[model samples]
Target: MIKRKFFMTFIVFFFLFPLQIAAETIEEPDVSSEAAILMDAKSGQVIYGKNEFVRMNPASITKIATAIYAIENGVLSDQVVVSEQATKVEGTTVYLEPGEIVSLEKLIIGMVVNSGNDAAIAIAEHIDGSLTNFEKNFNVYLQDYIGVSSTHFENPHGLYGENHYTTAYDMARITQHAMENEIFRSIFKIQEYEWDGESWDTTIVNHHRLVLGEFPYDAEITGGKNGFVSQSGFTLVTTATKGDLDLIAVTMKTNLKNEPYAETLSLFDYGFNNFKTEVIPKGSKFTVDNEEFVAEDDLIYTVNIHDKVSNKINPSGVLSIYNGENEQIASFNLKSLSAPVTKNITDENEENWQANGFLGTMELAILGVSAIIVVLVIQKLRKRA
Candidate 1:
């Protein structure tokens, strides 16, 4: 009985030890938002997520997508003729009058810096000729080019449209894609912009509290957008950099205005404390069964700061990365430096070759010897004749 009790205790300890170690390696942050995600901007890896895939209203953060799309598709110097419908857009505005001619560049500044619904409409109409066409084309662009599937925008500005919904993960991805554009990055990080519009002429400050240093946070606040509506609660998208890590945090559907900001700070802390990004430099070579493969471009990935990471490369030039817990965290397709050798053999023959092993080698040796003997016999017979 004593031995049996000791054995059971040992089994329990053995089973539970690994679970405890894994839990201690990386700690999750306490977040109040309904949907939130923390992503490595460089690698596009989600270090932490909570209900990130659940669709929710994005509010005015939709401007990030709109600004990037317009910058890429439209000429900045083109003068846009504001329509009556654009002037009538509700929510925030640059106070454009009907028949006002605004440069596309200035409109983008107003829309991004001031969160102007009027400028959003004007830019949308200028790019696509109508709000309806802008909505359709913009959704397609988000899905196809930005590679976000769970996002759909009914308006260029995020209003209370029933169909204007996006997931936290999708918002993070959209922000990541937008931050890659130099023009978008410059505009996104602006703390204040001088507005010289037809109806309004004043300095427009960024609405994000952290970007303006309204909140106490340690990391460098790079860029951010904030939004609110009756249906969507408070939504925030923030990008920050600390050390070698660049992070994007998105929080949506918080009841209190300060809740999303607090949660964003919590997420940034979690990412900066527990995770890190590493790059496999371009032209890095990997070997699989004597075949060589190379990373055609720089491959970036994130991992828990306290965990060991291992990489596995297959013959097809696919690299899979795993953390200490043996969980696969990321994967990349590599360029083949050399073609893998192919063997033409049936399953039965392959199985026989494996199973016979030394016996198969012995058989080949015997056959070779027999052939040699036959040749020698023929030569001796010819000489005798």
Candidate 2:
């Protein structure tokens, strides 16, 4: 009876242990944003997500793409003569008048820093010659190059068109890709700039409140873009840095402006605290079936701080990373970085065959070609003799 009780107790303990471990996990901060995501900027890994793929109005954050597109496709020094339509644009404006000329760079600054609708229209008109052409082609660029699978834009200024929608994940991805450009990166983070426009000479401040340091600059805010429309609610995409890790936080469809910012900070805090980056240095080795393979280069991935990472080398020399929960995070093919296993060759072709078996399907094709060549060479030698 004592043995039976002990066995039953053991089973109970085993079952309850997993629950206790689950309870001890770090809690994600509760925020009011209807959709949100936290991403690793380099790896494009989603660290945390809620409704990340759901499409919502992106508002002025659309300019992040427009800014990068102009920086890439338009010459900054080119002069643009403002048009009456640009002056008459309804929403935000830098107060442009017809016949006033400005550099493409100045218009980009106005559009990005001040969220000027007029400036955005001016950019679209100047770069692509018409809004319709700009919209059609830029959407293709966003899809084919930036690699956002689920986003659409009908205007450069992000005015509310029923077709203008993007996901939190897609926006984060777009922001990451945009930040890679030197010119676009320079403009996205500016806190304030003095404008000497024809009508407005006042300093137009960056609308990103955290970037302005109004919210304590606690998470090392690098840069960000925010957007709003009655239909889209409050939307924000922010980038922050900590040590070697650069992170992106995107929040959308919040009730108030500050709510998206609040959610963004919470997401950033949670990510920085709970995750640690692990690097498998270049030339690191793992063995499969007594044969050795070397890492092609440094492989970097982020994992939970307390999670145990198991590195598995399959027969094909592909390294698979498994988290503490035994979930496979990713896999990579490792190259034979060392000299042709000189020792293996010394041991005989047996070792070579053993090593080649684990190098994957392509290597098998190579072996077949080598065998055919060897047979052809032997036949030629016979003919000569």
Candidate 3:
């Protein structure tokens, strides 16, 4: 009876312990949406996600591509002539009338800041001469530069079409690329915009809720894009910065349920609370003067991880060794640096040149070819003899 009781207790402990550990493990947030993704914009690490690769309508998030194309190709100061087709695009508008004139910059502000559909069409047509041609260009652009395999665009506004859909991973990648440009980052970060024209008078308010910092989680939203359509549902791709780490969180295909904003806040808290950068030194040697190259010491050279993480009572700190832009040119790892210098062999250093690598290979090939020629010549001489 004692052995049986002990066996039963052991079985119970084994089963119950696994359950407890599983409960304690960090589970993906229960976002109400069918599809969602969260990535670290700085590192492009997807911290948490569900159905991230499943393609679905991106709604107004399509504007991220539109905005990038405009900034790359169009002159912001140039006034664009709004065509009849652009003004007639159904859905959200900054109310641009036909023949209405607005600066390219203002159109971007309206497109991104307000999620204006008409503004998207206007910008697209302006940038590419026509929406149809613009869309083909946009698809090629995504494939070439952005590497989004599952994305296709039918309309500039992302209003609705069977062929118009994008995966969450591709959308995150698009955000990552867009955020790299200073101007694009600035436009998306804005919460409000007042276009600079009388007839096109409108105050554009951003649709991204987290950008306003209303969530109780107290995370700072550095950048984001918001999208919504009847078929696509409410969607938001937001990047929030906590300490030095930046996280990009995306939610889609839901009616704003599961408190996505709150989930984002929780994600930020988890990320900031848990992980940190561990800076390791990049170079094997640092050259101080023309004559002297020294192996790095902790006092003279150090690994500069951007942030250090600690527990609830103690927070992280920045770890930096070098300062000034030019002085810190050695910050990146050796792989990031240019290939090592290759010196040509000369009469002064023929012996040293044969040590290894390209020079050695070239010298060996030359010697082998010369020896073969000499042997052929000797064979010909023997025949003549």
Candidate 4:
């Protein structure tokens, strides 16, 4: 009886415990969105997504593209003269009167924080001398930098138009590009923004609920942009971070009241509570025994990561060893680094270099001998191993 009990306990510990890996259950947020997606901004890993590739009107999310083009071409501190067309832009406005002088920085605040359609138009007109030319620049930037294939911009305001559309996946991709720039990032997170004594307040406080207080979830929402129109419904592009996992969520055509925001919160809860980021180091000097490895002052590798994985998940990364000509020599498990690794020969690592040199020479010698033996045997038996 004692033996049987012990055996049963062992079975449970080894078999059941291993299989008890946490799973990320995506609760379809109580939303009526036509398209949605959750992705890691850094790794571009999709956590939870629905109709991610379907294209639809982007609403005010168009400002993300507008902002990107402005950052690249002009300075934020530069003064802009509001044009008649910009002042007359329909819908949301920063109330810029014609010929009113404003800095490009204030316009960005209005564009992102206020979602001011007039500010977007003013900046667009200032950048390209006309809205039509600015839109041409936005489309080119979207194609080249943001990598949104299905996205097309008919206007900068994101007002309902014939061809103004983007997929959830494409919008997420656009957010990824926008987040990489510091100026664009800083403006997105500002809860309250002031522009020439006119302040634009957020309609729904904490566009990303996790970043604010008293939510059903906990996370560091880096920053985000929100959008809405009668045609596009409620739309959002939000960024959240927990541990090493940073994610971007996009929702389009959802209920304006609480559905999109609540859904995003739930998805983040699932992601952080159940999943963890797995950092798989591509190359380890200790394992590979290559003296030449990590010789570059600025080292970079082709890093591939599997993200939003269960805490118990231990995915074996695919590592292919190569030669000078990019020929595949061998493949094996890659060892991960627990801390930042310093590559190159240093005074402290003299012993490591000696050991690495010995190992490298022995490996080469073994290969040479094996090749010679195979060649000799081929002559003797007319066959070789």
On TM-score, the leading prediction is: 1
**Candidate 4 per-residue C-alpha lDDT over 101-120 given as tens digits, one digit per residue, 9 for 90 to 100:** 88998888777777778889
* Error of model 2, residue 202, in angstroms: 0.8
lDDT of 2 by residue, 1-385 (tens): 9999999999998675664465357798786788899998876778899999999898899999899989989999999988888888778888887988999999999999999999998899999888889999899999998999899999998889899998999999898898888888788889999999787789999999988988875568888888888989888989998887789999888768688877888888888888767788988887777678888778878777756667788777888888766788877898754445345466778777767776866788899999999999999999999
Q: Higher-lDDT candidate among 2 and 3? A: 2
Clashes by residue pair, model 3: none
lDDT per residue, candidate 1, 183-258, as tens digits? 9999988999888777778899999999999987888999999998989999999999999999999999988978
Off by over 4 Å in 3: 1-24, 278-385
- Note the Cα lDDT for every prediction shown: 0.91, 0.86, 0.72, 0.70
Q: Candidate 3 versus the native: TM-score?
A: 0.68
Q: Model 4 Cα displacement at 76 (Å)?
A: 1.0
Candidate 3 local distance difference test against the native: 0.72
- For each candidate, C-alpha RMSD in Å? 8.2, 11.9, 13.0, 12.8
- The residue pairs in collision within model 4 are none
Error (Å) of candidate 1 at residue 341 is 6.7
